[model samples]
Target: MPSGSLRGQVALVTGAGRGIGREIAIGLAAEGMGVGLVGRTHETLTDTLKECARHGSRGVAVTADVTRHGSVREAVRAVERDLGPVDLLVNNAGQVDRAEVPLWETDPNHWWQVIETNLRGPYNLLRCVLPGMVERGRGRVVNLNSGFALRPDGNYTAYATSKGALLQLSDNIADSLAGHHVVVLDISPGAVATDMTAGMPMFQDMKTWGSIPYMVAVTVDAARGRFDALHGRFIHAGRDNLEELVRRAEEIREADARTLRLRPYGPQDPMG
Candidate 1:
C-alpha cells in the first residue's frame, strides 16, 4: 500500500489528551489522515491538535465526555463540521479503579463508574458514529482492550468485566456489519508505560513494557483495513506476530482463534 493511502481520511480518537491516545492521534495524522482529538481537557487536546498540524494533517479538538450520549453526539457533529464524517473511530477512553480491591470490598459507585467509562463510553461513540458509517457502507473501529479481558483480575473486577464485555461488543458488531465493509477490532497494547500504568501498584516496579509504536502500527493497519480478515478478533500488540497472523488468517478463521467464544468440551460432550 502507498504511504498516504489514508490521505483525506478522518479519524476521531477518544481520550486523545495524553498517553497512548495522544500518540495514536498524532501517528494517524502522520499517515495523512485528518484527526479529531476528543477528550475532556481542552488544553491537552489542543496540544495534540498542534502536533497533528505539524504533521501537515488537519486536526480539530473537541471537549466531550464519552459516557454521555448527547455529549458524544455533539462531539461527532463538531468533528464532522470541521474535518468530515469520521472514517475511523478509536475507542480509547477508559478508566480503572483508583484502588484495587475485591468486587465486594470496592466502592459500588467507583466500580460502576469504571464500567460506564470503559463500556458505555464505547457504546455512546458507536451509536453516534456507526449510523453514518453504515450509511456510507464503510468504517473502522479500534477498541482499546486489555489482557484482563481474557483472564480475571481478582482485584480489578470493574476494569476486567468492562473489557470482557467490550470484546463481546466488538464481535457482535462485526457480525452485524459483516458485509457492510465496516470493521471492528479489539487491540490490547499490553502494559504500555502510561500515566494509568504508572499509577497502578502492580506495575510500580515493572521493568518490561509494550512498545507504543507497535500499538500505533496496529491501529494504523486496522484503520486501513489491513486486518479486515481478522475483524471482530483481538490483536495482542506486544506478543502476536502480525505478519504471521495475516499469513495464517484463513487458519485462524478455520480454528476460530483470537476471538472470545465459549470453550467447547470434548466432542462427546452434549454442548460440543
Candidate 2:
C-alpha cells in the first residue's frame, strides 16, 4: 500500500517485450521491484530493460519462448542468478490465432498454438516458480486473463477458451496457496490499447474502453498485495466501480468460507 513496498522484491514478468506485459513490467520496476523481462524477441526485451532502467529499478531482459519448458526454466534461472530469487511472477504471455475463424473452422495448428502460449505457458511458469515460492512461504502470482475469459463472443474459440481455463487455474492456485502467503489472482484489462489489438477490427470498436496505463496501475496494486482481498476473483479495468468490485470479491470469499454444505449422501456413507 505504501510507495516502494515492493522495494527489494524480485519480479518476473513473462511476455514483457511489449503490450500489456511491457507496461506491467515497467510499472513493477517503478515501484522499486527488480524486474525480469521475459519474451521471445531480443529487441523488444531490450526495450523493456531500458524502460525498467529508466524507472530506476534493476532489470534483466531474458529472451525465451514460454511455450518451451526448457526455455522458461533457463530464463527463470538466469533471472534468479541476476536479480536474486523471484518474489513475484506474472504469467502474461499469450497468443490468439485464427481470430476470424469459428471453432469448427479453425485450423488445428493455429488452435494448438493459442492453447500452448496462453495456457501451457502459464502452467510452465507456475510449475517452475511455485516450488521456490512455497519454500520461501511468500510470493505473489498474477495471471493476465482477459475479459473474454468471463464473457466470450464469436470467433475467439481458442483465445477465450484458454483464458477461461487460465482463470480456473488461478482460482485453484489461490485456494492451494492461501495459507502460504502466496496470493494468486486473475486480472482482466478490459480492452486496453496494445499492439496485439492495434490493427484488429475490434481495436476501433473498443478504443473508448481505456488505455494501457490505467490497467498497468491496477496491476501494480495487485503486485503489492493490495488486492489480496480479491484473490481467486476477477477485476475488470476501466470500470467506475473498482471499489465496489473489490468489495464484492471480498464478500464472495467470505461467503464461501462461511458456508460449507454437505454433499448428498453417497453409497460410501454408512450414515446415509
Candidate 3:
C-alpha cells in the first residue's frame, strides 16, 4: 500500500532511467508521489515510468541530458506541467572516470565530461527549478553525494572533485534558502551495486553492498522534510545509524558536523 506524508507531492529525479535513480523514482511512487523521471534514454525511462504507474502514482518520463541548459529547462517545464511544481528534486545523475587512473594520467576529454555531467548537470537543474521553488516558498533538493567527496582517492579525480563541490553547493544553497523553507541535503548512497558501479573492477569480488531500501528511506525522509533540521548536511545511508543521527541532531548542528569546512589551529586562531 502506498503510504507516506509525501503521498501527493511531486518529485523530479534525474538519471531515473536505471540504477539508484530508477529505484528512487519507483520508491517515491510507491509512496504515492507523482514522479517525473528524467534521463537520457527514452526506453529505459519508459520502463521506469511503467513501474511507477504500477505503484499507483502518476509518472512521466522526460528524456534530456542534464548537462544542457535547454534540456534542463524543458524537463522542468514538462514535469511541472504534468506533476505540478516539483516539491522534491533529486540530483542523482552522475558520471565517473572510465578507469581508475590518477588525475595526471586521466584522459582530458573524459575527465571534463565527468565534470560537466556530475557538477554542471546539477547546476543546470537547480537553475531551472530553484526559481519556482523560491516563488512557492517551499521545496527540497537532495544531491546524491558519495564518500569519495571527503576521502582522498588516488583515482576518480573528476568524480570526487565534482561531488565535493556539490556538497558545498548544497550547504550554501541550504543556508540561502533556509528562510524560504527550501532545504537542500546531500546523501551518500554508499557503494551500492548499480549498473554504473557493476563494471568497476573494485567491486568485482566484493560481497556486501549497501542497501537500496535504506537509501530510499533516507530520500523519502528528505522528501517529507523529516530531516529539515539537518539541511545542507551529509548523510551516509550505508554507514551511520539514522535514528541515532536524528537523536544527535542538535549536537551535530552545534558542532557544525557533517559538513565540509576548514579547521582552525586552535581556539585562539585568527578567525576565532
Candidate 4:
C-alpha cells in the first residue's frame, strides 16, 4: 500500500519527458503534488505535462540537459519560479552508453558520458537544491538507482559503476543532513518495460517485474518521508521482503532518536 501524502508540495522529476521519470511525475501529481517536468526535449516534456494535467496537478515543463550544470541550475530556477520551492527531487535522468561492452573494450568517451549523466548530473542538481532545502529544514531526495548497483552483471560496467557511486552519495548525504529534516534515499526499481530495455535482445529473457505504476507508488511514499527512518537505505520495489526492511528501518530510527535525546554527544547524534 502507498503510505504517504504530498498535498501542496512541489516535486521536480528529471527525465520526466518519458519512461520511468514520466510515470513518477504523473504519480506525484495524482497524489496532489505540484510537479516540475524536465527533460532534454520539449515535445517529450509536453507529454508529461498532459499527464500531470490529467491527474489534476499544477505542472510545468522545462527543457534542460542534465549533463550540463548551467542547464540544470536554470531548470531548477524555472521550476521554483513556476511552481514553488522544490520539496522533493527525483534524480531519474541517466544514460547507458556502454550497454554491451566489456570494461576494457568500452570507449572512454562513452563511459565518461554515462558517468556524467548518471552521477555528475545528480550531484549538480543536489548542490543547487540542497541549500534551499536545508534552509527550509525539510526535503526529500530519491536517486533512481538500479538493482545492478548491488549486484552487477557483465557488459554493464558503465551503468553499474555510476549507480554504485550514486548509492554511496545518497548514503553520505543521508548521514550528513539528517538533522536538517532531509531524507535521502536510493530506490532501485526493478526492470520496467522502458525504452532502455525495449531494444535489448535479451530483454525478453529476463523476468518481467513490476510496472511503472508500482515504482510511482514507491516514489510518492519516499517523498512523504514515510520511509524517512530508512534514510541511506536502498529500497527495491515490488520485492516481498520490504516489510522486514521497513520494520528494521523504523527500529533504527527509534534507536537513533533515543540516542539523540539521551546522549547528545553520541556519534550518531545529528546535533553533534
TM-score of each: 0.96, 0.89, 0.96, 0.88
What root-mean-square deviation over C-alphas does model 4 reach? Answer: 6.2
Q: If both were scored by lDDT, which would come out higher, candidate 1 or candidate 3?
A: 1
**Best candidate, TM-score-wise?**
1
lDDT of 1 by residue, 1-272 (tens): 32776899999999999999999998899899999899999999999999999888998999999999999999999999999999999999999977878877999998999999999999999999999999999999999999999998988999999999999899888888878889898999999999999988999989998899889888998888889889888988888889998899889988888888777687787766
Cα RMSD of all models vs. native, in order, equals: 1.6, 4.5, 1.4, 6.2
Query: How displaced is residue 207 in candidate 3, in Å?
Result: 0.7
Cα deviation of 171 in candidate 2 (Å)? 1.6
Backbone collisions counted per model: 0, 0, 0, 0
Order candidates by lDDT, high to low.
Answer: 1, 3, 4, 2
Error of 4 at 15 (Å): 0.6
| Candidate 2 local distance difference test against the native | 0.83
Better of 1 and 2 by lDDT: 1
- Candidate 1 lDDT: 0.92
Which pairs of residues clash in candidate 1, taking residues 3 or more apart in a chain or in different chains?
A: none
| TM-score of candidate 3 versus the correct structure, residues matched by position | 0.96
